[model samples]
Target: MPDSAGILPLPLFSSSLKRDTSRPVMLIGFQHQGNLGLGYLASTLREHGYSVLTCDFEAETSEIIESARQSKPMIVGFSLIFQFYIRKFDALMQALRAAGVDCHFTIGGHFPSLSHEETLRMLPELDSVVRFEGEMTLLELADVIGTGRDWHDLQGIAYRGTTGVVTNPMRSLVDDLDSLPYPERNFEPEKALGRKALPLLASRGCARTCSFCSIQTFYRTAPGKIVRTRKPAKVIEEMQAMHEERGISIFLFQDDDFPLFGPVWRRWAYDFVDCMHRSGLAQRVIWKINCRADAVEPEIFTAMRDAGLYLVYMGLESGNEEGLKTLHKQVSVEQNIRAVEMLKQVGLLFEFGFMMFDPGSTLESIKQNLRFLRTILNDGCAAAVFCRMLPYDGTPIKDELERAGRLLGDVCAPSYDFLDPRVSKMYNSLSQIVDVWGWIHGYRALSPQLNWAWNEVAIMERLYPGIDGLEEYRRRLAAVTKKSNDVLFSVMDNLLEVAEFDAAERWDNARLDALRREFLEELLRERDAFVEHNQSTMLRVLRAQPVQEAASA
Candidate 1:
């Protein structure tokens, strides 16, 4: 075991005119819970013959400052992903400045990739923000710093001096993704921030540009570059590393749309399946990956399952055909239905990530979505994790929201939690929908108290109760959910006293089991309730439609 010292040393670079010295580059992965970027970059840097250290940004403000004090490098990089993490990173730098620790600070990832200019303006302690794909840019930046050479030579950087943001053009995308080292095999995973399911990146950039997306915009920052992926051999190498080094077989593929780009991905999938067999990896492990509805063809979906993909996270963003069309989803309602059915036919498990309410959607539209979801869920692949449309900085929706004055203050990039005010405001709408939805399904496996409260209301209203309007219904549901969460947390707290698992693992298997059961139970009651409401609403609306048509006729 090595000390923090020499981990990211800023050895004064001896010029090539005198002698060449090694430059130490520290790749800081973002957030307290598992870092994929730094892990990848750490291995990348080490391969390039640079000293590298990877660390997670913790809640303790002193953590970065303390680490900086202990091992100050030529370049201190923070692997920023979400917008909230950027704010937290700013605070970390402020803490460091307060404590008198001055080291060259930098950041990269999704948020910074889009808002590098604003990031530099807001966070004064930051030296530069890497704009595009970071692996090469970061290495070059550290090289310049270690040598104390000209800053102008570095590409893909946004830095501030007396004149303010000096933006450099981003480097071209890595031509060959297969040439890069695997992050898991190259760096450490299954450690730090209490995450066991190693998050892996199979590819970079995206193929589609739906109106609500930022990935399309961000990827285009480096023009003419198509989405790139590592060879299947490399992907399996990382999995093998996870299995061998961390004993982690399960993974979460954090790709934007993994399976969509047909032939390239299929090659990787076949190689992956071959490696899984050759390496003797666990057959039962769940490796979840997300893809667009049109990406999973029946044959390809079957190939994926053959390769040991246990779960496919489908972003059936909206159930309504018009809503999907409005969002430029490119896939039709029929295509989505077929995709889900394909996954089911292959005997693979999956869950729905749905957006029931679009910005312009009304109550009627929501009911239509409910009917659509009911048909989809009828096949039993409907464990819903509701997500509202997130407006990223460079996305078209963000621009639209800004023009309409609906967006407030740097509300584009989501923070570390992926739930900022802008998005969470929508989440508030989602919560309302969830409550109504929960009332219909009983909120089982989702929110226990909500189920209990809704059930009580149902029982009360049935047994000779007056009308409990929306407000009264909401207040009672809130109280029930609050009480349920409190009891669950308290029980867990007592168990923790006697438990041997660390605080991070405390949120693992047992907790997930408890949460899931509660959610399912609550949802069962909610489903029945939803059915009743939906049928009534649909009949009324259907009758009204014919009457309006008759009048027009």
Candidate 2:
């Protein structure tokens, strides 16, 4: 439509390897280690007459980059879902550049789609960023880029030029999902991928706004504004195929919002769970789904658990009213509490996410949050994650924070290297907040930080003056904290280093316990120093508050 015939990027396939119409163009769909976006992109690529190469970003960035060069693919795409994966994306892009290879380096996923400008700014090596619904955009891109024409004119793509940033309008949402091909796993059907669990999306987009969120913003990409999902039977078919084909036993429902309609969700949950259970598929397969905290009912929980539901990922983003109010999360704390209790009593395991930092938070508000966790989920059945608020540019909250001048001018930072020279120690304070939130929440919300950890929180809050009583909560969060930390760390560690997981498994029993104790000791030492440092810092911030307010006024 827009003179794209001439502007498309060219694909660089191996010269020795003759191109055949039957030989599908290679589509590289990569996500981080043991990730499920792996499923989404891989499946779609295979459907559109393309062979797919899949890999994890956990391999050294150089490794991922080098592999692309060696494979000499037609298209190399990275799944930039997490903010931390930016460095790896750049590394791969760089490798493509170094080889002078014509491989089309593309990125399109939840995180990148929302922040296309950021992607352009950060990873120039990427030829372009697909703004939304990558399966189609990628398909069309491969056709155009491989043909050496005007993919730059294609809709829903973001590329740059001497003139400036060129952002093609988002393509209309796909109306008919039934005809879409199933998600393709990367490896051969004969190979066993072992028992690592992953999340899969049956639908695209969320319809609700839980304050401290970007879900609603993500939903806006679809033109008509409706959550689209595959038929329930097809969902079952995909799972069945994966189980039979790839030996995949566990699946996570990665929908922005599963069962957007309450009644529909109930009906689907009942039918699907019962169906899976009846067919004996549930025996071999377990699932984890993401849904509105309030959408789940006692019956749904019961049916889900009976159907071998391993976990239901919940977004409890906050414990109190104030935090929920800020994000406009459209649900109540009571609803959250009720939903959580039902899941627990129904024998369902849940991983609920909570956020501590907010734009207008006060000391009392923050404490109320900690107290909520302390009071509510202090057991093994449910968990809480405490993440910080990132000023995602497309999120409603981001708009609010930006207007209030609390939004960080630059939300983009260096990609986290969990195994890097400097940063493997911990994510920056913001990212630490994210991981710690998950860590603490993972142990069932009642988990406390070690003495030293709490002490550190206290000291930081004091120094920062707005973070509230983290040190105090850390101290109180003891047994549950230790166990929760272990659970959260262990799951993540297993997921992060699956190849070395076997070696790590040997120490799981005693070694995990020992690590917990060792972590506790480290927290204790850190806590003492934290107290002294924050105490002085708190006094300074307090004394300056009056002057700060006056200057702003």
Each model's TM-score, in the order given?
A: 0.70, 0.69
What tens-digit string does per-residue lDDT give for candidate 2 at 336-448? 88887887677565666777555545445555676666556555233345655566556766666556654544555411112232222222322432333323434322234
Per-model lDDT: 0.60, 0.58
Error of 1 at 181 (Å): 2.2
Clashes of each: 27, 28
- Which stretches of model 2 miss by more than 4 angstroms? 1-35, 187-196, 380-384, 414-515, 518-553
Which regions in candidate 1 have their CA more than 4 angstroms from the true location? 1-24, 31-33, 184-196, 278-286, 379-381, 412-553
In angstroms, the error of model 1 at 72 is 2.0
Using lDDT as the measure, which candidate wins? Answer: 1
**Model 2 worst lDDT window (10 residues):** 414-423
Over all chains combined, what TM-score does candidate 1 have? 0.70
| lDDT of candidate 2 at residue 62, scale 0 to 100 | 66
